[model samples]
Target: MRFSRGAAMVALALMCLPGLSMAADIDGGSLSWAWGIPFAGILLSIALMPLLTPSFWHHHFGKVAAAWTLAFFLPFAAVFGPAVAGSSLVHAMLAEYIPFIILLVALYTVAGGIFIRGNLHGSPAVNVAILAIGTALASFMGTTGASMLMIRPLIRANDNRAHKAHVVVFFIFLVSNAGGSLTPLGDPPLFLGFLKGVDFFWTVRHIFPETLFLVGSLLGIFYLLDRWYYAKEGVLPVDPTPDTRGIGFDGAVNFWLLAAVVGLVLFSGFWKTPLGITIFGTEVGLPGLVRDAGLVAVTFISLRLTPASVHTDNQFSWGPMQEVAKLFAGIFLTIIPVIAMLKAGAAGPFGAIVSAVTRPDGEPDPAMYFWATGALSSFLDNAPTYLVFFNTAGGDPATLMTTLAPTLAAISAGAVFMGANSYIGNAPNMMVKAVAEERGVAMPSFFGYMAWSGAVLIPLFVIMTFIWFR
Candidate 1:
């Protein structure tokens, strides 16, 4: 569904509200911890509902999200008055959710249009090559995009194999999660950091080593595992969907659009201007406006220019995007009070969280931040989880990128990397599983996937904590 125009109209309507501009700020220290319950409720809904009641969640996920949003807002208005609630909603929408969703839609739409044609034999070497390529592309096109683009071809390549579930599992590990650690464009958590005024290159520059360690280790492990499987199971006598043509790309025009997407994101980060407008309590910068508008143009342009056949081959639909949009809309709203409480620091209700991540010298502990952010991100939405720790670490981007750089790196690396710890850790983890299952891969169950991650990924994270986060 189209969101840009609707988002703009909502922003415009909110801007016109009479008293919202003068609303007082949320008093996080004064508000009890109960304000965070709606946020917890929504996150729990996201984590459990799908696994426990797939059919009901599939049909009514949006309604569930909306219910949580109201669960927060109605009580919030009753307690704090409508003006405060209105301004909070406006700020969350204009400053955070709208910009976030726009970039995702642009990437999703453009990337969906470009399909990789032809197939290769799923030899261990060939499988490693595909995973390597996907890992590299994930930093640019996003994990979701790279996962979608590469999964089908990889599946086709391995369809002739007797035992191949491990292949998809490693695919989730390398392509869908760890590969996206290096850039804001790569994953939702890093993007939220960028939106919070972290530089576009901050993550890549800071966490490249961690990303290399994780991705390289996972790839190496997968290669050895795949080789053993190939030796044991051997290939089917007849290849399913045998290679008919040399591997090449279709809908190449989207490459230009993808480049445009990158350019827009970078331009917004680099271009600073005093020019901006105030909508309710939020400041909408001119460069941000231009960047978001450019993304929307690129999205529709890809849809228009790419051949319909290309989209058909890709099995592209807006269902996933719609689901992300609705769920995150609730998340961004419910997270407002939570962020405020976090910003309150050691004196706030969440003082224990601060104490947990802080050293005796009053310095933030990188190791604690790493595991704390990681442990929560394993089950909650990584994007908001990142935001939670971000504000917890004082919510000052300048300080975060400088003296506290290691702590920032820890948080970033944790949210992105530990997302592979569970199927629901990142959105793309489940998407990859669903696609693989549809293609006849006997994918692991939810707990089964966790078993894989616990075995493979947890050990690596432990080693990383000692090597880097310490």
Candidate 2:
């Protein structure tokens, strides 16, 4: 009954979506600031509702998302006509949202199938090693994948310790956010950048230095803090989850599936094709279609091949993926006008934003871009916030990659790295928190986590600004 209600709500919302015909393009230069209200509202709701009204948000988040989608669609159709609104909706869905969700689904499914069996004691060194390994895996398998795959073992390893919450906090910092900086597959914002024409290896090539610095600094800090805690509150005499078997992987075949996902993503980026179809105003390329279809196949294949015991051991469920899909559906829809207005640059309603990140010489300030993108990414969903800033910095991937390389690097680094600032900042942050709490670890409250980030992450980001963004 619950599933049906949620599905029905999503279906009803889809029914209200704009028509399929292409119409007049939105003139961001002419759009009023009010057009951005729905975008802000939805993001704010995602950030606040879970903290303030957990039960209501948990039960009705999909409904709230749908409501915001309607808020944008109804007003848009009324003011701009259904044809115009439909074109925008189609463009967003076909060009951006579908591809984004498909990749996440593939990653989530493949990652969820692989269960890490057995556990080890959580000495400070062992915890740091787990964090470092998870951090490295994050670049290849995704932050979500690495987090889901590694969080359990880390928790189990530390289950006997009295002061284990800091271990999980560092896991969120290094594995869930900063470590994903090296690859597009590692983070949603980078994937979005890839979808926008940034080269497959562009992020790694540009931000490797920044990633190494942030991740290394985080690991070092976590080690010192964890060492103190370990000494202060020694482990219980008996391990809570003593090793029952040698540490090994269940559903290890998914590693190959993970490799295939990386291959498909790379193939799509490199394989140029003139053959394509048009959907509404957006062109659907052969490479993209192949990529998306292959990803869907990978998702199902993982589900079919993985043993039920592995999934059970992993506590795998579709709940997190479902919530993300529904929430981002609204985010993609509402962000249409915001992206449009941002594309209009200084002449648009968000001219102040443009000016704030601009230098007196009419160029972008990399430091300002870093801080601005990071500040909001700390609060809003980083993926869409990335798109917003990507457009704000003049949305041409080629130009941003070359002439404004520093600006683009700042934006990328900020969006991916500072997402560690809050639980709501990145998807995996909350997931890791929930998993830790489920295991009886007393994870900090939302603001308390912020206190951790502010004390630790903020100083690191400042040093990064001077060394790199400057």
Candidate 3:
């Protein structure tokens, strides 16, 4: 029995495992050969993060944790490759993740520098008000739009305040992430669910209970924190001292421009819908139009319409967004090979994982998928991470509830709501950070932001687990 000690021991342990499936068997072909490369890549990037941003690493252990995760998963790409995968991983990364991340940075930089004009005294209350409004708006305007509109004011309100890192951290949890749970328009993952034939209104209905729970709980917490901070600092509420220069609604043009962009978004989603499209010499659809329109709108805002004075008032600059854009762009390129591998190995490589578990109701279990997909969404491109889960959830009888509708509801809620675990989880989060920095509220770095989530948000999610999922 000990003839081949270590190797044999490993083989025995693996085979004896419960629910072990054929997916674990590596054929040693192209797919098997390609496995594990992504894990290495992730590890390398994580290791390099601290080296590159030592000061950031100093207080942000959470960033270091994420870096380690990146390191660990990078190799999984090699284990996961082309022959076993389905969609082109490059398309997922580029078409899904990169553009949105870039857009967030650009919007944040522009708004942060130009529009933020409030003082820091009343910022906490304003931030709470913003989160409340944002949660409601998420259902209508989309979390991205609402976050973009509110983040600048939040930053401006807190501009004169120090020791407010917790404020922005909690802001991400409430307004950016948890708030978008109720509707397809609120989050991309839910939107993808809508495109996949799930009833759009179903998610909105089922998630209402969960949304109310989170909102009520978070707002209470935020108020206590806000009051405490205000009292400790002797901060007074600030009023927006009116500018008597009497420019009649001309400055409000930005609002109109912003609205125009929203209209374009709605039209693109409606017209070139995932239902498919064929246009002059090419077939383009939801993805195509969205990418095109989003870029066009952002470009117009960044390059053409934003007046010099607005930037001056908001303290806007291009650097933050550019940095985020560059980083995520690289991420988009690097993750393609990995995702491709995962899909390629779907049947055999991850078969065991895919098939091992079942829900309490004896349906196909989606918890693993939810957690893995969610973990990635928190750090990488949330949209693609979202799609990956949505795509994975497709066609699985086990993932559904007793009825088709409940199953879809579950998937949509998980994808949209949980995506807010990290700054990168939602586009608005990073923008909020850039805006905060522009207004001089020193926010926690990438990982530092997570500590706040781990402590506050994770527990809240546990309550949700029992209340909703259970």
Predicted structure with the largest TM-score when compared to the true one: 2
Score each candidate by Cα lDDT: 0.85, 0.84, 0.55
Candidate 2's C-alpha runs over 4 A off are 1-19, 192-202, 236-238, 384-403, 437-442
Q: Tell me how candidate 1 scores on lDDT.
A: 0.85
- lDDT tens string, model 2, 339-437? 787667779987777678989988899999999889878866788778888988889999999999999999999999999998868878877886677
Candidate 1 lDDT, 1-470, residue by residue in tens:
33334444544665576788874688777878999999889877876786899899878887887788789988997888778888888888887788877887887788888888887899999999999999999998889878877887889889999998999999999999988888888898898788789988899999998888888899999999999989998989998775676878999999899899888887786787989988777789999999999999999899999999998877777776787777767777888888777657677787687679999998999999999899878866788789888988888999999999999999999899999988768878867776777678998766788889999999999999999999
lDDT, ranked from best to worst:
1, 2, 3
What lDDT score goes with residue 43 in model 3?
Answer: 37
Off by over 4 Å in 3: 1-94, 97-120, 236-250, 272-283, 290-298, 301-303, 341-353, 360-362, 366-372, 396-402
Task: Give the Å error, residue 372, model 3.
Answer: 4.4
1-470 per-residue lDDT for model 3 (tens digits): 11113222323443454433223222422344243454445434544555577677434533433343344334533444322221222233334544465445433433332354434344556677767976787666567667766666565456555467777777777777777777666676766655554555666677788778878888888888888887788543443443243322223556555555545544545453345453211234665566556656665665566667776655556554544444444455445544544444346454443344345565645445545555666665566555555555554433442354444444555566666676666667766776676566777755677777777777877776665664
Off by over 4 Å in 1: 1-18, 161-165, 188-202, 228-242, 379-402, 430-448
* Model 3 whole-model lDDT (C-alpha atoms): 0.55
Model 1 clash tally, residue pairs: 0
Candidate 2 least-lDDT 10 residues: 1-10
Task: At residue 364, give the lDDT of candidate 2.
Answer: 90
Q: Rank candidates by TM-score, best first.
A: 2, 1, 3
